[model samples]
Target: MPDLVIALDVGGSSVKSGVVQADHTVYQRRTTPIDSSGPAESILATLAAIIDGHARTLGKDAVLRGVGLGFPGPFDYAQGVCYIHGVAKYEALYGLHMDAELRARLAWGPKPPIRFRNDAEAAIIGEFCYGAGRSFVRGIGVTLGTGFGSTFVVEGKPQRAGPGVPPNGWLYAESWQGQQADDVFSARGLQARLAAAFGRPLDIPTAAQRARVGDQQLQEVFRRFGADLGAFLYPYARAFDAHVVLILGGIAHAMDLFETAVAQALRLPVRGGALGPDAALLGAAELFFA
Candidate 1:
């Protein structure tokens, strides 16, 4: 196995890339927010620059095995195609052959293979391999960030999209509380809910801060978030027969506010992400080994 690989976790808000060792140590990590509103060519150019810059920094002596990428869906991983049309973000990637575009811009000796998977799937794989899900044979991973990301894994492999898993193995579009899960479980959802309840604009951090200070309204928001999360995952947990459900990403930091509700709603074990955001990058790299 190669000692190092370039890994990228592409989210709706930002793209995180790094050179990661087999043991999960990261080097030369870089993160930048993506402009989903920008022109498609510009987005592609930004991605190209990052990949080229990383490859150059790794130097000619670096023996990189391949590049592994975890990106949002819906996408065609086999053909390196993106289908993010009408989504909240990354819509410019729609119908683009992203893998070829990146590879064309990467100037490295002996072009390496590039593997792609849904960001949620990669995150879960990372969790199973090195985080809270490590001990469980059946696990479900959810990343509550710009959007809801989800995947089911069993015995170290991700389950394909099916009856229980939903389309493209994504939980974001799942129906919940008479609306889509994406409408209730994402960063936008949190902010929107806060605005409606408090009659003002409130970002996630401010809401969390207020909750910490015993602000009842803010506290209720998080509690509702927790309750909704629990309600959303209840069926999935039953379907996957999950031993543990790992919650990850920016929203996870407020677990103290909503942990009780989530725990009560979930029958199985539930925990915050042990590896945090790095889990997806690490998991993306693992694809090379697999």
Candidate 2:
């Protein structure tokens, strides 16, 4: 019988789940929209349904191995408890013991082990194990999207403290130029710069499109963002003696727009993630495999 694990990347607005084989290939995958702000029970029910659906798809002889999740913070990944509040998402889950709730709802013959990891950490782990960071011994992964997410990895394991890593290995709370790194490096940051430049707010996708079409002003905005990102990462990269940096998330799609500036400033190899959204799911599965 084949052994398969269910892996999930839980986000504020959606959940990406997959059935992964021992070889790290996803046999089946799904992305489900979630109203994270909804009632806790409703959200839990949705998650249960997703899991049950995947379980039903397995062949009769397949053995369920475990369930793994990549969730955002402030969460207790080790305990499967949620402390996320005031984030406009997953508020109803505050103080909830997710592992117990999930276990109670599963219909499998024997409950599978359930584990969780920080979403950013999971992404980096996926990269380290299977994607762009596969060749490096130590590196940093940055996910630039609705917010700035970061993690440090050594030998395929996520590290929270050491030389060059900020408290909790997170850069979002760190200050750069009197502003939180999240405020300066996220999608909102790009929009803020674009708004300041054109006297109106412009979304990242629109800005990228314009920049690609020879909109010099928009192009400059991305370049400046890249330069600033590089400047911010320089100290940490040097401190950690990082060998490489892997960029992930929606913003990474536009890396070409700013790759030059980041490379020039950081003076290190910067590469985009090769796994796309699957990185987190694969990384989540690693909680059990590792």
Residue 210, model 2: lDDT of: 90
lDDT of each: 0.82, 0.90
Best of the candidates, TM-score: 2
Displacement of residue 275 (Cα, Å) in model 1 is: 1.7
TM-score of each: 0.89, 0.97
lDDT of candidate 1 vs native?
0.82
Question: Candidate 1: where are CA atoms >4 Å away?
Answer: 12-14, 32-36, 59-62, 87-89, 161-163
Candidate 2 has a TM-score of 0.97
Query: CA lDDT of 66 in candidate 1?
Result: 84
Q: List the residue pairs that clash in candidate 2.
A: none
Candidate 1 clashes between residue pairs 3 or more apart in a chain or in different chains: none
lDDT of 2 by residue, 1-290 (tens): 65788999998899999998888898678999999989999889888888888988888888778999998889998899999998788889999999999889887656778888989888889999999999999999999988899999999988889999998899999999999999999988888999998788788888899999999988999999999999999999999999998889888888989999998899999999988888998899988788
